[model samples]
Target chain A: MTRDAALLLPSTEPVTLIDPDGHPVPHVGHDLPDPQALVRAYAALISARRFNDQANALVRQGRLAVYPSSHGQEACQIACVQVLDDGDWLFPTYRDSAAIVARGVDPVQALTLLRGDWHSGYDPHATKVAPQATPLATHLLHAVGVAHAARLRGEPTVVMAVCGDGATSEGDFHEALNFAAVFRTPVVFFIQNNEYAISVPLARQTAAPSLAHKGIGYGVPGERVDGNDVAALLKVLGAAVARARAGEGPQLIEAHTYRVQAHTNADDPGRYRSADEVTPWLARDPIMRLETYLRGRGLLDDQDVRGYAEQAEQAAGRMRAGLGEETSADYRDLFTHVYAEPTPQLREQQALVADELSREEER
Target chain B: MSAEKLTMATALNRAMRDAMHADPTVVVFGEDVGPLGGVFRVTDGLTAEFGEQRCFDTPLAESGILGMAIGMAMNGMRPVVEMQFDAFAYPAFEQLVSHAAKMRNRTRGRVEVPLVIRVPYAGGIGGVEHHCDSSEAYYAHTPGLHVIAPSDPADAYGLLRKAIESADPVVFLEPKKLYFSRSEADLTAPVPPIGRAVVRRPGTDATLIAYGPAVPVALEAAEAAAQEGRSLQVVDLRSIVPFDDETVCAAVRSTGRAVVVAEAAGFASVSSEVVARVTERCFHSLHAPIRRVTGFDIPYPPPKLEHVHLPSVDRILDAVDELQWEYA
Candidate 1:
């Protein structure tokens, strides 16, 4: 016979539950969250998912060239972003537009950057975030650099470098963490451990048993969080941010989650994995699991569901309307943006560009 | 004109001292560059005179040093970063390529970074491969940076001073082998414009082109050729980028046959570009194909092989021999 809660086995393992229907049950820790706060997180997740959907549609319609999905990682994004204080810096990877949205960026700005426009999404300082960088693990050092800047300026700021699990395989990642740990720079590295990196599996990525343990090599504390459980993620991120803001150097966090869809709208994962492998995770979906837990505690109902759907739809509609309404960047932007003082060579190059453009106009 | 005899190293130190004295925002820092006075002592007594804040030693990390300099530059400070050796610049490449060269373009001209990278460059020091390598071509190919090398005490003082005062990011390549070589420094007059090349000696037969340490080699070759009654014009292409094609074209048009020389390798070298531009601008005016006397097309050799690898006085004379011979 099983014992009661008081007589249960003592273990350091995280709390888990099983649904009565032979399905894995969800956690109630985040279920007990405040209604307004939960709605903010829910609203952000919905908006991000809607934007991801529309961006793919743009790619298919040929309005945009490529789209990388952030569909199933919405909870990990919103939860981690909730703990950032004002003036906190983020070195975001290419799959981090959801976090960027939560960090106060207008969706059109991301569209412009994705369209290969010369201007970045937003000023790194103005939005407290750098534009999404595509090169794997390179932005990790940039985040450490930002943390060092904060240390020198005596500003109580925490820098978060968010990347995928595949990014840990890069030398720059280890270099950044080692630098942060040795220098005691105020930085937190958040890895959204989404199972695949454009088709490369995490199992093929590392042999350390867990991605979280990789930080130990650099003498930094690390944690593993249930990324689908918004409450667990928020709690872990809040603690990490607090430690960093207190000048305790850095923390490494591995947010374990699964992608309920393909790597992007362009690919079919069926070539790699079966529908059966992903079916179970969809039933325990991040937003769905949170919604069920909230409903279990009487925090959500039909009306709340209706409101979130309406908000997400309207936001998507606004974005769809604003897609091509933004200004188009010119070729002059290429050489103009490179140097404050365009070298004599650049000036000559621009003159050559102008001459060619003028000839094209004549034709 | 007041003249003083100083080695190339002392002249550089004096020029830097004058710059730091003239501008409050000029900052200097790198490895072993403070109390130890740099490996070559080119920055000797700088820390003592300017205080530790302005001239100090940085952490051993190259990326960290450059990353901090970029931050300082963005914050309205003109930082002069010393990349310990020519090859040490590789570690700082990301900061140079991704940030320093692109900050203005990435920001759409809203922000400008006027950072200067001063590197002790090229071979002839009894050092190994990395120390003797010439990386000027790598930076010259980058679109946003201005790369320039000085061939003499006067050009070194003037170009470095101008690079410090310039509003753009400049790669100041200091020829390491010439640092200790004694030179006459004219303390009286201001240095000339950095963007133009000067003709050291006018010749009617062939144009001998070079810059930095190679300029002296070209000069010596011209003097030796003169004893043989071959009038060779030596043109010093001081600034690599924004090359003084006005003077180069004029020289090529007059001399008809041009012999280019560089310490860098012949294949895809800076001199290769020089050959192309001079050939293109003065195509029909050519008395013979543009001949380039340069380092061999291989990884920079050891100190023992350097004499053969680099373009020496004999190599220049050989290139002239290959050019239209006016000896008859």
Candidate 2:
């Protein structure tokens, strides 16, 4: 279990397995996930990066209104998703582009949200997931509820709720942790400590050392893992998930990562942090780490690497194609989904719009 | 009949138990609900009868209790989440609004969160602030969430069942003031439907609309007006949000005058909607402006001062007294 105490928090104490130097530590047991699993994780992360990149390009091309990239933070997301079964649920926040994708949410689904066409990124019921909650830590409590319900049903399903580090400032985070701990609900809270919540750094968010160590107050097992280390993250996340599924309780895993890309398409990281600051995290990239690790094992070659890159491109193209197939607005659906059975007031509004359109057409 | 005269607390227990027996999907959760049987003992003998799993105690967090009900509802279970008090629910409002209310629509008609959030809502029991305060208006404003409140035991049973059965998330506001107000409530008989307003007394002078704590106040005002030769009609508006506009409209159209009464502050209340809608629908029928007998727009005062804050028999009579009744 993760010992989440102030002493282990990253601000007061450093939280890294193999530092940026790529040197492995002996005490920190790296139950390194299988090499094949590592390759798989790298593939998904790379694909997510491609998807985010393509979407960014599309945004610039006047396709999508905005796009948030999971550029340097795919390790924690894909790793955590690898730990859970299909029955398990995921509660993702606005910036978790990769996390939502790994939870069986199509990249194109989030386009609806980016286009401001719909509130939900995807069908939560179909994926056993929840809509991407734009609000910060508030949905964390709902994730806690999912676990509590699983316990009520005598089901062994666990809910892994993902959020950014800055979300720790919100009262809802404390409530969710306390509830999960007290109830012993089967939940794993994955904090993708992406360094900044749209500009408010982790420093402004909490005085309580590390985000992981802060969970001790609620008595939930907490740990900080190298968000760039897919192998380590998956291993720790797998065990924590197993513990929750075993009816032990909730666990908080803070994935220490950096957002190498802009917070979203609209954000300018240059104003807050310098390009020099992002240089170090860029070197410790999750995709590059797994790629380097696989190369060292001789399990992958240059040709295979090129093939994987091609697959990422193909996946992005397919996602772009899928975006085209979505239910378009036609200006009619805009007024449709507001309510199930449109109120008389809304219907009147719709009729008025229709009448104006008819009059224009007659002209 | 298996029905016996019981306190409001005991009646809630019976209704919950019967609900569990009627549907295996029914489950309840709140703080100290298991062996403790809740702080008020309303859930007493329930954990024993239904077992700890079905009628269980949750952690101290009220948000978790309510949020989990939405999850259970998604999984095809009828979860009656108990908010220990009205104020504790503030933490979970995001879940209630962003998740619970929008889930069905967000899923594009693919999902329904059939959850019941039972809150011991209202003041006068002197819970200070956190435990008191009638904040039903907040839920009513949020679409996709159904809001219902019941004063008497009979309506409590039927409405609770209806709320549990409804496919939408329901905010079931239980008046704490009426929890111990014992009276004859038929358990065997089916009362008026959950959302319908029941006309307790029929008259043409004015329509007195109320629910929860204000229902008794409205009834008392109707009786006092009758003694004064004033034929005031009373409507027990069972549901607050997605409020019984049809029923409230019917009463107002019949009487041609309206007085909305509630334990909450008169400012931007669920009753505020009632008055606006009533006046809008029955505009020409008005003999006088819509009057409201409500709790003052201030913090719930001390126990002694609570009488001054909440609507009393005298306040409604005062509002009714303001009206010009045309009939003999």
Tens digit per residue, CA lDDT, model 2, A1-363: 445464323333334444444444443544567778877887788777787788888788777888787878877768878888999988887777667777777777766788667767677877877777777777787787667767777888899888888888877788788888877888888898888988878888887668888777878867778888877788778888998898888888888889888988889888999888888878898777677667777867898888888998887888778765646565555456544455454566688999999999999
Which CAPRI tier for candidate 1? acceptable
Minimum summed lDDT over a 10-residue window in model 1 chain B is located at: B67-76
lDDT of 1 by residue, A32-120 (tens): 34556666777777777887888878778766666777778887888778889877877788788778877878877766666666546
Those runs of model 1 whose alpha carbons end farther than 4 Å from true positions after fitting are A1-36, A119-121, A296-301, B1-38, B41-80, B91-95, B110-114, B153-169, B184-195, B200-205, B325-328
TM-score of 2: 0.92
Q: DockQ score of candidate 2?
A: 0.45
Clashing pairs in 2: A9-A210
Candidate with top DockQ is 2
lDDT of 1 at A325: 65
lDDT of 1 by residue, B18-130 (tens): 98999877878878889988898988999999987678786676776676676556545677878889998888887777777776666566546677898999988878878
Per-residue alpha-carbon lDDT of candidate 2 for residues B230-279, written as tens digits (9 for 90 to 100)? 89899988877556677788888888888999988888988788889888
DockQ of each: 0.30, 0.45
TM-score of chain B of 1: 0.96
Q: How high is each candidate's TM-score?
A: 0.86, 0.92
Docking class of 2: acceptable
